[model samples]
Target: MDRIDVHQHLLPPGYRAALEANGVVAAGGRELPDWSPASAEQVMAGAGIGSAVLSISTPGTTFLSDPAQADQLARSVNDYAAELSAAAPRTFGFFATVPLPDVDAAAAEAVRALDTLHADGVVLLGNARGVYLGEEGQEALFRVLDERSAVAFVHPADLPGPAVPGVLPFAADFLLDTTRAAYLLVRNGIRQRFPNIKFVLSHGGGFVPYASHRMSLGIFTQTGRSPIEVLEELAGFYFDTALSSSAAALPTLLTFAEPGHVLYGSDWPFAPEPAVHYFDAGLAEFPGCDEATRDAIRRTNAAALFPRFGAVPAPVPEPPLLTRLRRRARTRIFRVIARAAGRR
Candidate 1:
């Protein structure tokens, strides 16, 4: 089917060994699914996806606290995945992993992967060692990514809080992890500032689309300025339909995300074949869009994101003039209210 899957996952042998050494037998509290290039290819064919952009899932290099080791494991994983992509140019392209909380190493690897390895993009966790994205400390990393106009694919890792006994992190906590990242990114103006870098939040941005107004209000509550001013910035983020292609979730994601920003994603092999097929079927049957829109979401949107894959240049969207005008008008009122009273 000419679909381009933008959020497919890979498990590198060396990275798996590192996880085993660290006693992390599970990722985000779920058993890791078996993955090989052959298996991946078969799954893609079954799902009717033409290409799968591979990435190492959560508990990635960030799981390793040792900066040196993190860097080493990241480089090795990237190298391996790059080799896989190189071997199967048509079926695979990889999003390079980076050693986060180690800005220099990440930047260097990013340069290598993008330049030499010909990686499609970079995958980053929403948080590393309790440091969420858009925090002051992560600014350096963001700057490097922004310089290249890189596609920054953000995946959710385990949240720092205590885990509830019954529910798995993927079932609940993962969603909040992504939402929190989106929150911090927008409130801190990172999303606004980084126009060049395209940030794709996985799992359909994990409630960001549904709870956007609340999130915007939350930002306004903290900072005096109304988040209303940058609501368009929040919508600019790309969302992937990884385990999120449903009637319930699609409405918000489609309505809230800018057109051509929602791309297809099958969270395999982490999702396993059964689960992957379930969502793939759901996407196929979802009545959210007509043939044109579905085609755009499944392939054309991603093709726009990774031009090397399909070379379909993105149709430049006209700016939201109405939103901009509303922002300008509301900014004055919010500023007056903020100045009249100190932050709550």
Candidate 2:
């Protein structure tokens, strides 16, 4: 299928230089790299991806302590993304950045980015300045997204609490942060209250897939809810396969999530290796899916979430002869194996 990647990132040249000049470090104190738009396009093209939805990854707009500087950087980043999308209409779409720690300013910027800039959605770090999205002070931000029916792209950010020594923080902490936010939303009734907002969780719902049994246990034993109930609610949530590209993880995600609930994503610039790895893993492991289901995850699901790519062509269909041959081969193999086992 002609794939649409919904989790790419584009860094403004000026902003990137500033990060390097200021010695700003990302998770694990790794110095930020100079991620340019050209590099992003090259990577996407090399992967044979048709289009990508760009978002600010981490150390988000609020990284600058000064609210004014934060706002300016956010605006610049959004404008740069919009400009890049214009240059290659078929190759790029963007999720606008918002400066947190100042709700009023962030709301205003959100309106402008959506209405004027035509941003596909808004990118929000899971925790901004140590505050989770559903917390009391951050309620207004959620209200804005819900009111606008915006796609809220939630990615992991460093927590405000003290870091543990000898632990590679981001590797584990990032997924845990996503899990924490998702759990908070469900427990606090945010999903039920704000049905209009569409939340897209990065990294295949971030531990939600593997730990689902425990979630079900908690509900049945303590909360009086079924796993199906939790899963159904979570089904309304969207997921992107960014870095968790394990051989087992992708298939497990397909089993847990309906095809329409998953989208293609590459947490680019920060870690392009994951993007390449996922494409390889998905292509090899998911060959059994029908074309329709494969098309949905590869491109259609993202197009539905972000209408910018609504007009992009669907994947070309496979030939009937090839399909028949594969089916026959599978049947023959099964028959041979069964006879050898004396089932025949």
Ten residues in sequence with the least summed lDDT for candidate 1: 316-325
Model 1 lDDT per residue over 1-344, tens place: 68899989888777888888898889888887788788888888888888989999888887677899899898899899988888888789998998886777888888888888888889988888787877776667777778888899999999987889998999999999999988888888887677788999999999898887667667877875556565667788999999998878887787677778999999988887888888877777877666777888888989887877777855845425654465467557656665655643
| Runs of candidate 2 exceeding 4 Å displacement | 28-30, 216-228, 273-275, 287-290, 312-344
Report the error of model 2 at residue 220, Å: 7.4
Task: Report each candidate's C-alpha RMSD, comma-separated, in the order given.
Answer: 3.4, 8.9
lDDT for position 323 in model 1: 40
What's the TM for model 1?
0.90
What does the lDDT read for residue 238 in candidate 2?
86
